[model samples]
Target: MNVKGKTILITGGASGIGLEAAKQFLEIGAKVIITGRNQAKLDVVKKSFPSITAIQSDAGKEEDAQSLFNKVNDLGGIDILYHNAGVGVPPLNLGVPNNNHLKGAIYEMEVNYFGVIRLNNLFMDMLKSRDEAAIIHTTSILSIVPSAIEATYSSSKTALAFYVQSLRKHLQIINSKLKIFELLPPLVDTDMVADRDDKKISPAQLISGLIIGLENDKYTIRIGDSKVIYLLNRLLPKVALNLINPNKYNEKLIN
Candidate 1:
């Protein structure tokens, strides 16, 4: 779990949180390989951190993930699979109609949900092939509760959280040396949440907490408002579920 000398792969690793995490991993002396949909952005990141291996790949594609596995195999092996790629869709104008919802759902599912599935399935084999490894998913606080505004994004993250937990149980059954962790970050000031008028944690702080959690072998890590999720889940289940319900009754939308 030590960051030093470990090789880590982070999907969607070009900008925002992914980029921030990549930068931190480089500082921690880990060999960092980052993937993203945009080659141009990866180029810019390379200019800043030449040590990182930036691969231009769409994590939404299973074939791309398989190719990623090939890349990892060529590297000898990987110590950590940081599933950091994601997207936020369902543009504000359409207001969650069926078509817009479907579009958003596809984008979100492709990147956030199924993308994780393919990445995990492919990298997990490589991880188990090694002596020890770690698998981490970057989800959102919305995964536990509906945040109202990001309908499609929220739903996909919610599904991702469930998937991570399920993966953990399966790993226990197989008795794999690979450890699984989930990061439920609060609202962040990234392109994904640039329009939202909400408080956000800086990317560096989030990365700092994330590194500490992973290195310490913490099973699941939550930062900022996501900590509220753990507290609410433990102390107030009904209120937690109600908070996740989108508050349609109090709001004028569905009421």
Candidate 2:
């Protein structure tokens, strides 16, 4: 899993964790292709990193995934598919609990969960035929724990966490070399988080975890704050659940 000389495709690469990953991969000398929904943001990112390949595609859509595969295959085959694009930002501390804004919840699940699945379903084949194929997903602490403000987002990742668990077991029987890794990142200091130090883990640290996951060839990988969740979920599922479920811990958040 030497990152150098590998061909890679990253979804949601215009900004945040995806863009940071693209930069890190470029520094390590990998052939990088980045996809984003926003043309302007993609253009800006492309300008910043002249060597990177920037394509416009919404990673959440099935058609977008298909088009991305076609375009990447045309340029060159892919070795690593990084599904990192996601969205989950709404007002927390609303002074009410179970504050389920139906729209916000839907957006969280659609963008964070289904979006990654769509791309993975499409790109799995392209990577499978190649040597040293791998898929890296960006999950969060909420995936395994709770967040007062990120209820839907956490739930989406939790579902994803389980989905990958099954997917990994199936892939193991078919192809042992195909690696699956999840980054349980802390609150990252990206646009995704505007008011917290928990997102303190740098993109570099996350990329380092990616490399470690590849080198070890481990079936499951967890890094940063999500590591806390993984441990807590195992030894203290109740504790972890209480911390992440907003309505449970925050009285004001309960309706």
Candidate 3:
């Protein structure tokens, strides 16, 4: 997958991992377009990177997804559709049933799982038409081993991980040229996890690993502890679980 000279569209590109990916991709000569829900953030990104295109769109909304597809198609479809947009609801105790629990779970599923499917469906035909096209899905290490504190977030990522595998196989069976890539990142140091005290990797480190994966055609790119956890979960499931949920998370849950 030669990313140089390719056009890439990244969702949730205003900040965090997505923003770092945009910067790295641009450095490698890829034309980058970023979409985000916040107009102010998108405006700031555009000002900072005049060459990068920034579009204001919510990944979780059906109408916004459709509008984004139409706009991207008009601008000439992308060779790579990077699904970096994801959301995690604040941790809540599932043992105590509450209305907010269901609402939060639904929101997480919509943005983290269903939104990836929605955008992929819209861009499938366009991607297929390209000579060398790929879809990158940002799944999480929690998908390999669920987190007790972040149960819904883990479930959403797990669902997406399954979908990415199935979608890749389906594309292969159909003899399609389009490629599906899954990126599993562990405890990234981003605004989304600011309150967490867990060991974290910088967004730059994650994106650098991702770019290397893209260049080498590594369909499943696991970064940092994600690679460690994936192997540990297979060989030592209990140890993997203990590592992910430590004592602090369990204490919080009990209290």
- Per-model clash counts, in order, read 0, 9, 0
Worst 10 residues of 2 by lDDT: 246-255
On lDDT, the candidate that comes out on top is 3
Clash pairs for candidate 3: none
- Candidate 3's C-alpha runs over 4 A off are none
TM-score of each predicted structure versus truth: 0.89, 0.87, 0.99
Cα lDDT of model 2 by residue, 74-182, tens digit: 8877898887888885645544454456777777788788888887887778778877888887777777666766666778888888888887888988856777877
Which lDDT value does model 2 have at 72?
83
Best by TM-score: 3
Q: For model 1, how does the per-residue alpha-carbon lDDT over 1-255 read when each residue is reduced to its tens digit?
A: 777898999888999999999988888899999999899999999998888898888988878888878877897768899988888863443353556667778988999899898878777777887777899898888777775556678889989999999989998999988899999898788887676555789999999999999889998899987898768978997787676554543343433
- Each model's lDDT comes to 0.83, 0.77, 0.95
Which pairs in model 2 have colliding backbones? 96-253, 96-254, 97-253, 97-254, 97-255, 146-244, 147-244, 187-199, 188-199
Tens-place lDDT per residue, model 3, 1-255, is 899999999999999999999999999999999999999999999999999999999999999999999999999989999999999988788998789888999999999999999999999999999999999999999999999888999999999999999999999999999999999999999999998899999999999999999999999999999999989999999999999989889777877
- Candidate 1 vs candidate 2, lDDT winner: 1
Q: List the residue pairs that clash in candidate 1.
A: none
